[model samples]
Target: MTSPDSSAPLGVFDSGVGGLTVVRALRELLPNESIIYLGDTARVPYGSKSPDTIRRFSVEDTQFLVSHGVKAVVVACNTATAHALPVLQATFRVPIIGVLEPGVEATLAADSCERVGIIGTAGTIRSSAYQYALAMRKPDLQIHATATPLLVPFVEEGWTDHPALKSVLKEYLKPLLDKGMDTLVLGCTHYPLLIPVLKRMLGNKVRLVDSASTCAAHTQRMLEEKGLLRTVKSKPTLEIYLTDLAEQAEALAKRFLGTEFGKVKKATL
Candidate 1:
């Protein structure tokens, strides 16, 4: 593949706004790099969908990013990473980064107890991507994965600290806690919002691995390695687009971004 223009924007996408966490990280690490983010709000939960559907949506998302002159593509959604990463990489000339492998590596590096727990959407947990990656690296590693589908909606609603959210987290995490997992991988992009609650529930002893941070770090390294890192030190642009507008999406974007998003536009794809 041809080398990308260093000055081009990087593309990041998810089923919805959760991918902004990855954007948040990228902004901190690569402040000079422009970023284009797409939220497929029309179909917010790719986790429950079939692999074929996820692949189609991922292709469309990548196409939109490509049209915008993105230097590389970051699949910030765990469900999409689990199901459609390979296809995306194969079809696109630009470098493609996914959240799963980086998260798996981080979890393995942080855990000495050989026990890892993963919490994601149904599709992610069901894909066994983390389990297989960990097992391949260390055969004796023990993994327990659970699908916490409700947490996504809770986050989308900007209800990270709601009592109902805590109750749901408790119920969802009880099984992994019982399994004596020493490290918990926040397998969904939206999951980092619950870190405070997760820390309270899982305590200081259990490490929480955020896929968004890992993915961003990975993107930085990959870009530098490929000589695609932008060198200009000016203000980087951030453009947010959604396929369908949700009433709460703008509010959640403000909360996630820690600033007003100014305006959100609709995407044809």
Candidate 2:
């Protein structure tokens, strides 16, 4: 509950392994900055959960990171951002970021296009979070959305490109393609793990967007503005924690993180 410190690691959390997309982006954008990541594997797939449940889980996740002394926190889960971000920003002392705001900003900044498509989990789409944000940015923009709930489970299970994946992705994205969308936002963090398949399916005509990179960029800019940039003196380690330490979590997460690190030790809540 104190101010962000440049010397501290940035905290990133999501309902599950999907947050690695954000961590990967952070590593690329701010190589020197230390990072701490948490995956609530015990409560994976917040997309189907109730809003109050998402809020409670998000609060616990944020507190876990704050207690560990992170300078800033990023809520990488779209469901959490849709339901919990405002409360966290208002109550937390340090600067807090979420995929929703930055993602919307990035989507709106795309070349003036009329037709936009959004693909995410059922909860995210049902919340109408992206639609609302898009409306605020461009009231006249034509936005189409469909929930791709299975992709998260598939990605979480490390099934990025099984033969079944193409069919699943095609079915999930057909609505967007049918809407004549020139741009598509992968609104769920886990969706980025399937970017290669998505890009292939969506092709060059439809721009595929992942907010992780933009979110990381925004985090770096915020820290720079606050003079909270970290100077690395040695190998900065990334500490990970998970509510449930399933072996699959470790195996699959490494793929998204682009590394072979083992399972995160269970967090002490």
Candidate 3:
């Protein structure tokens, strides 16, 4: 395998369009580094899948990105990261980073983060990846985690402002709020899109730690440490791919990526 140079694009993959949030963050933090994103839209919700299946899909996704000569791979999906990160790191030579550790670090770094609440998909919550990581770092921290399976579909459907979404958010967050959580960790990449709504509901008391931005920061540090940071001052590029393109794929991608969205191609693995 050819070693990726500094100019090589960074690879990011998710179970679906939600991963674009990480792409957006990376674009803001490291504008000179190009990126290639892959969304496994055909099997969109890896959240409900078994650990073995998630691991298998993640490996295929990494292989696709590595084949394209990415300097490193970012597992932008929380479910994939929780279940498959170890396998991916063990199997791949290129640097493989995930959203879980960055999110845990960010959560711990928050001011007065004693009582923490984590929200993500069923697979992520079930895996105990976030909870264990947090506990390992700070044994006394209080961590409450729950699966918010509905939010991803709601966001993908472009229903961020739907009244039902707010209701669901309230219902999903009530227990954590009642527990007096001072910091909320958006464990899934998709959860970043709901920051405004979350802030409004949780008010100024709860600090929100967005995994996308934290993961991007972690990626930047890893690149710099490895001497793979792109130093060119030219315009950075973004390429998007989806295993099964939905009619609303571009719209959803735009929602997650904001103004950094671009044309998305169809990918097969």
Candidate 4:
């Protein structure tokens, strides 16, 4: 692959609109850089897919981004990051950033607690990706992981304050709370949308570690290190593509970005 010029837009891909949270962070931190975002909405909730399928989808997504001449790619989906990051990095020429490491680093940095909790889709929690990452960094850390699969659908439906949300939150978090976890890692990108409710439920005693901002910070540092940082003052453009046409995606994206995207085109991949 030819070297990507600094002017090339950064590529961000997720299984669905959840990745927009990462895009939101990127826009805030790297305002001058343009972005191309891809959402595989047709086969979303990748939390249930097998590793092989996830890897294949991730490869195709990366290929799509590379075809657009992006300087780097961000695997904004937690399941994809957990399953396919190494393969994507080894195969792709440009820098590929995954949400896992940044989230893990932030989780550890938040507090020096041996009892740490993690919540994500069933696939993410079952894969033990966060657990392994944390153990590698601190072998003594006790991991309490739970799969809050319903939260993803709740977030997708824009049910931030639905009457049923609190009940589910309590059910999913009580175990970790009982374990006396001082830090909790929102393992899935969709989980960040529930931050306010999560904070209210977890309270101030438990620190929440969100990967969105940390991942953006990591991307900025990496781009700077590689001399690929965009510094031009031109208005940064954001182009979004999704595998399926979803009206909800646009609305959810606005929720993440705090502004409506100029366009949301349907795509096949």
Q: How far is each candidate from the true structure, as Cα RMSD in Å?
A: 1.3, 1.6, 1.4, 1.2
Q: Show where candidate 1 strays beyond 4 Å.
A: none
- Using Cα atoms with residue i matched to residue i, what is each candidate's TM-score against the true structure? 0.96, 0.95, 0.96, 0.96
lDDT of 1 by residue, 90-128 (tens): 999999999999998788775475788889999999888
Q: Candidate 2: worst 10 consecutive residues by lDDT?
A: 260-269
C-alpha positional error of residue 232 in candidate 4 after TM-score superposition, expressed in Å: 2.7
Per-residue lDDT over 1-269 for candidate 2, one digit per residue giving the tens place of the 0 to 100 score: 35666789989999988889899999988888888899999988899999898888899999999999999899988999989999899878888999988888888777767898998888889889899999987989999999888887788666788989888888877877888898888898887778888777767898877888888888888888999889768777788888898888887788778876644789855
Clash totals, every prediction: 0, 0, 0, 0
Clashes of 1: 0
lDDT of 2 at 194: 81
Stretch of 10 with least lDDT, candidate 3: 255-264
For 1-269, candidate 3 gives per-residue lDDT tens digits of 65669998999999998999999999989889999999999998899999999999999999999999899999999999999999999999999999999999888886578999999999999999999999999999999999999998888777888899999998999999999999999988888889988888888999999999999999999999999999887887889989988877777888788884656799998
Candidate 2, residue 203: lDDT: 71
Candidate 3 local Cα displacement, residue 170, angstroms: 1.5
